[model samples]
Target: MPYFKPFKMIILGFDGVLGSVLSGALDLFSFTGVSWQRFSNESVEPRFNVQIASLGGGDIRCSNRLIMQAHCDIRDVTECDLLLVPTIGDSIDKVLKQNSELLPHLVRLANTKADIASNCSGAFFLAKAGLLDHKIATTHWAMPISLRQIFHWWTYKKISL
Candidate 1:
């Protein structure tokens, strides 16, 4: 069998983060190669090295009151293949304010070769970090206010997929 290097994936965890979204993203990435291999009766080899990170490697108090432990401190994470910002379950403004310290780390990661993505309203974080500047962005349809309206420097477009 050929050796495979697992893709490094980091999921940002924070207070007011949607519990379901956070866990779902972790499960989806973690089970990618293992699930298919198990069903195929092959050796189970996971494809991603997934970890949940918070500012200080502390426990995350989710919006629905679900508590999640972090795998590592966001500050200690210097590299990754992919970084995912999950949907915010609470008020966007509040979440942003509470997690303001993350913006610089987001910018630093964005400057790396890592692929950055967001689910639903998670785009707000990317936008707030100035990572979405000059890049077309979209958010959850239920988001009443547009990303462009909030971040004047962001280039947002409605995407149907």
Candidate 2:
């Protein structure tokens, strides 16, 4: 098999989910590429090609009024070597009710062997696609009980954020 060069890291974003984790990872690593994407209402919006230009400057606001910014989109993700899903909110019920279309694409991406990483409540998306079944995972401590209650077959570990 031919070895492919590692290119950009793609960060998936919703309206409220922050993109800092993805951006920080890029800054910490010597990646040849990095980018982000917003998957809104069953459609994907490709943003700018990520350069050092997009970091340490802007702010993006989360649904909970948290501010964050300075991230690129998936169109900038060519030959993606890593993908990050940042923590969103605690309401899994609300996310499913609102972002139902997000899962099928997530499942498709996972099936294609994308290196999927999630933090905090981002696990909810994985769970929705049945990806967390029989796998060890972590989430915010306050929500583990509810997560376990909903995903009975999966083990949820409490982790400090």
lDDT winner: 1
* Candidate 1 per-residue C-alpha lDDT over 1-161 given as tens digits, one digit per residue, 9 for 90 to 100: 63899999999999999999999999999999798899999998889999999999999999999999999999999999999999999999999999999999999999899999998999999988988777766688767366667886655445679
Candidate 2's TM-score: 0.60
lDDT by residue (1-161, candidate 2, tens digit) is 22343344555655456445544544544422222222234233222223321222344445666555545533333344455666775356875556665566666667665677677887877887788888887777777887888777866555558
Worst 10-residue lDDT window, candidate 1:
151-160
Task: Identify the runs in model 1 with alpha carbons over 4 angstroms from their true place.
Answer: 158-161
Regions more than 4 Å wrong, model 2? 1-4, 19-61, 64-79, 157-161
Each prediction's RMSD to truth = 1.8, 10.9
